[model samples]
Target: MLDACYDTSVVQSAVDLANTLKPVRGEDFLESVGQLHDFLDDHPALGPVKPSEPAEQHAAGARWSLTEEDLAEVRSVRETVRAVLERASTDAAGAVALVNDGLRRSRATPVLRVGDGGWRTEVVSGTDRCSAHLAAAMFGALASVIATLGPNRLGACAGPNCRGTFVDLSRNGSKQYCTRACAHRVSVAAYRSRNNPG
Candidate 1:
């Protein structure tokens, strides 16, 4: 199981944006316009985040709609986020610079609210619509990850056949593969190598 520490919606949204760009078996999910829309449909946060939509407007208007322009904007942001993640894997300073630039562009501010658990902090974003909403949420998460976990935790998989990037939300920093399936495949290969001995 993934560590629950980075299990917030913001983090997951960021992860989804990065994952869509990273290839898996020669297939990239956001490679086309149709696919991009499909990705939005599949992802909860990126689709239609109605943070303050009115109930009556929802009946008469399509407030939760995505335009073609929105898709392009999101794809652009996805690329930027992916670059930052890739940099974080090897160049912490570069990653920080990139994420800082993203935060500035997003114009997201931290707001505190009292909750049942305790006082909680949230990014009160200036962007309150489709692609911009996704971008802002992703950057907010990136900022938190860089500050708390450090940028080194953002990385692409080392598995020979995998191209997915993962946030290291583990209790210990033992995770190198993106998924358990990838880890198992590597383990099986190692076992075979030891037992067979070419």
Candidate 2:
């Protein structure tokens, strides 16, 4: 599981970006490239900040500056990531294979740094576009999540009207809904049905 805070680096930014692009607020808010661009601009963490050679100051990563091509690629990446998450939710091995293949395609490599705090692992990407970076980050974060929390921790929303997905980082791993609002919507609907019974 990713640390509650990125005291280390912006490793979870990809995960944050992925979660945000998903039909914000249970609505299809990210269907078009303009919306995706708006999203990147709306959220600071969603974009990667180009750092020095030693990989320093990653908090304010470089602006994505998405082009027409990048947007198209991002659409594809998002679809593939959603599939990977869904598959991993039910099948761990399959998910691993998918992530490995994606890493290969994105040319992402795992780097080990030996510091005073001991050795640690981080994903390094050579890609320049925002979409490619996010794809790599999505795979890396998902891989880390599977290693720590298990496959079932990631999945799509349970709400009938919502097409969003999420990673359940709750305590008991009993997170049945994507958000509390979705859960409440479902609960209120159930209560109303029970009371009316029409």
- Provide backbone clash counts, one per model: 0, 5
RMSD values for the candidates in order, in angstroms, are: 4.3, 4.3
Q: How well is each residue in 95-151 modelled by candidate 2, as lDDT tens digits? A: 788888877777776656554556656555666766666666567767777777788
Error of 1 at 117 (Å): 3.2
Instruction: Report the backbone clash tally of model 1.
Output: 0
Off by more than 4 A, model 1: 1-7, 31-63, 114-116
Query: What is the Å distance of residue 107 in model 2 from its true position?
Result: 0.8
Q: Please give the distance, in angstroms, between residue 172's alpha carbon in candidate 2 and its true position after superposition.
A: 1.0
> lDDT values of the candidates?
0.67, 0.63
Per-residue lDDT of model 1, residues 66-174, tens digit only: 5677777777888878888777868988888877777777665655544445555555356765556666667777777777777777887888878677777656766
